[model samples]
Target: MTSAQVAKEHEGGEGNRPEEGYERGLGSRQVQMIAIGGAIGVGLFLGAGANIAKAGPSLILMYALAGVIIFFIMRALGELLLYRPVTGSFAEYSREFLGPFFGYFTGWTYWLMWVVTGMAELTAAAIYINYWFPGIPQWVTALVFLIVLFVANLISVKLFGEIEFWFSMVKVTAILGMIVIGLGVLTLGFSQAGDTAAVSNLWAFDGFFPKGVGSSLMTLQGVMFAYLAVELVGVTAGESDDPEKTLPKAINTLPWRIALFYVGALTVILCVVKWTEFADEGSPFVKAFEVIGIPAAAGIVNFVVLTAALSSCNSGMYSTGRMLRTLAENGEAPRVFRKLSSTKTPALGTGVSVIFMGIGVVLNYTVPEKAFGYVTSVATAAGIWTWLMILVSHVRYRRAVVAGRLPSSAFPAPGGAKLSWVAIVFLLFVTGLIAYDADARVCLYVMGGWYVALVIGWSVLKRRDPQVTARRREPEFEKL
Candidate 1:
């Protein structure tokens, strides 16, 4: 069958209908919240403290620049999603536009990316739990969270969406509250006598770039990592009740979300507390609250960050399950993963992914101090790879449209293919930054081994299943 035939078979055929495949249970509201929740995670709530300490107030600029690049990347993804809204999303796009090898690599790599990311989020969740239950072991916290989210996912996609919706709402409320209170303190002098909340705090202490421009540039890797799951909105398209409406709205709102959440919130944070006062170990939100004399700031921020971590973990599980099922559908993974539950969820895939995430609980006990750093670095590298694939696929997708091989998408990316190139170059620059850092260089080394293993695994799977290889080599698109 031709590529168009394959897409039709997967998307509209009776065998792949909602009752047999993924249910379109995720409503527009759930999708919108999931998009927002995915963008704001532990990276902003907790990791921003260290980034602020490293680059002073200048970190805000890095986030803005990175947010621009992320916007372009999402636009590229949005175009592709509208062109063909599949559960596989980028992986399927890679198969059609790049090649099957790329499809296989992208799908499996993304699965691994979320697996590692889920581990990191679980670790962060454990640490946040420590704030409330000092005597509970970190591993126990990780285990409990893992079990709870795993069960939640196994139940149904709607349940998962509901959980994410509420998780994201809490995060949104916290940031908005912080921004409102922060502005009050800044303009109305609503802070303690010694706490001077003013916009001048951005540069009063030691200027915005206290650590020099180069130091701020170095934090781009972390800033990019914060935007890792924003493209998850694309993944949701396959199960979204209204992909055409919800996907575009979610992608278009990128700038506004970043402006309000990251740029606006961070600006207020710095205005509330000097960058010098932020600690690498604690949350800037909590610190800002304490600076303004909030009595339960630590506990409140702890709960927010805890929810952030859980939100990420929840999203990671959902994406991994769908991705694994996609890989199985494309013969990149075992056939067993293609099996769906009565509710149309990829239960087997979710179970396997959770089993691996359980190892994160063990890592929390074995290497508690270094676990987050290690997994985050690897996740960042993997995330970069996924973004690059999206851009490349978009470039080819546009070419196909221009060549009259495919229909023009309703939501084409602005600047056409040029913006994709720009985003691709920016992603490469961030990858270079990762390689330049001694602490982060290990991620590249790990990725090197990962790709090597993928090639080897692909070779083995090809030999064992020749028909699968042959099917992959077939035309990915129908010729006009």
Candidate 2:
């Protein structure tokens, strides 16, 4: 079938899924794993070390604080997902509630977020490999992994899900093992670190907020970035075999995921080793293992974190393709992105996104010292925008339901629209934090230029395709 035919078949055919053109290949197991994988990634594996150096043990509080807000955001999204689950959950909700312009901006910005995030991931993966192969160039390794993941994603969604399932499995297993080991050291007092390892470590070393509360709050940018892809489960709503059953279950587990993998893990790691000893450039997990004198600790944690980076980059590839197709179907992006290969992959979107991510290779080559910092700052800024859109969309969605313009969701949030507003304000605060940081402030400038480009592209699209400016139809209450 032609590309247009495929789009029509999926979106407009009677008695068909809204995500018809897409393959429903991601089963429950894969969705759960994807959720776990997204919850923990390079940000925690690597970024936390730097954040800890600055925030001290207070970094754990940063994560817990942010985790609560993240829970609110995901529950809001869960409500919307049940209302109308699609691959481009953020963009679609914005289109329906906010307007076409917000939708267009959200769609493209999310795509950009993941593309740069992919770059950051690729760079991080290379750094992880450097633990063993110090001689290889970072750019070379970044290029190799980028190409491998691109090819893997090109084959089929099932393959992507399968690969993600295993990648997430490694991350989950690694964190659990690390936590267990740390707890053992704390209770048994057998390992070398055990002599000094105590819960008192958290308050010792000049107090928990050693750097003061302001510095710890500043770490929220990186802390929130650590939780960035936790929402990828919403994006998978389209391909999930059972959206209602799987999406809620996946989102519900996010609290403990954040607790165990982020807050809980950090608490244990800090208790085992003083946060002061962590190097800004190294993985804390690796550092903890090495401090405990575990044999080959560096190599073992390196491999797990390598998978974490690759896993997030892999997700970037998947989400960008689906977002591109969403934009294309709505006449915002290039229609060629609407095409699915015989293998049911959005090859064009994935291909184009990977090419953009190749910019990371160049960044790694010329500015290896600063590539991860630069790309992550930008990705975090973009992620904040995408999240704001989601919260705002959820708030608007709740307003409509209350006004009787739409039906209430089956999985309504406990605090309703109030929590969404709280999440929005908190995200805006994080955005303010990003602006204040000199190193991260540049991302806001990048986003300023990006918004200008999006506005221009949107206007251009408006003239060429009337659908680009068309407002979405209002849905009646009760049933589809």
On lDDT, the leading prediction is 2
Per-model TM-score, in order, reads 0.95, 0.94
Local accuracy of candidate 2 as per-residue lDDT tens digits, 1-480: 322233334454421223558888899999999998898888898889999999999999999999999999999999988777778888888887888899889999999999988877788788778878999987888889999999999998989999999999998899999999999999999788989999999998999999899999999999988888988998898888888889999999989888999988999999999988987778899889988999998788889988988998999999999899988877888878889999988899999999988986686667757756878888888888888998999998888889877777778988999998988989989889888888889999999999899988978887887765875634423233
Give per-residue CA lDDT, model 1, range 79-138, as digits (tens). 888766778787887877788889899988999999999888898889789878889988
Candidate 1 runs further than 4 Å off: 1-11, 14-20, 193-195, 470-480
Give, for candidate 2, the lowest lDDT window spanning 10 residues: 1-10
Q: How accurate is candidate 1 locally (lDDT)?
A: 0.86
All candidates: CA RMSD (Å): 2.7, 3.9
With a 3 Å backbone cut-off (N, CA, C), the pairs that clash in candidate 2 are: none
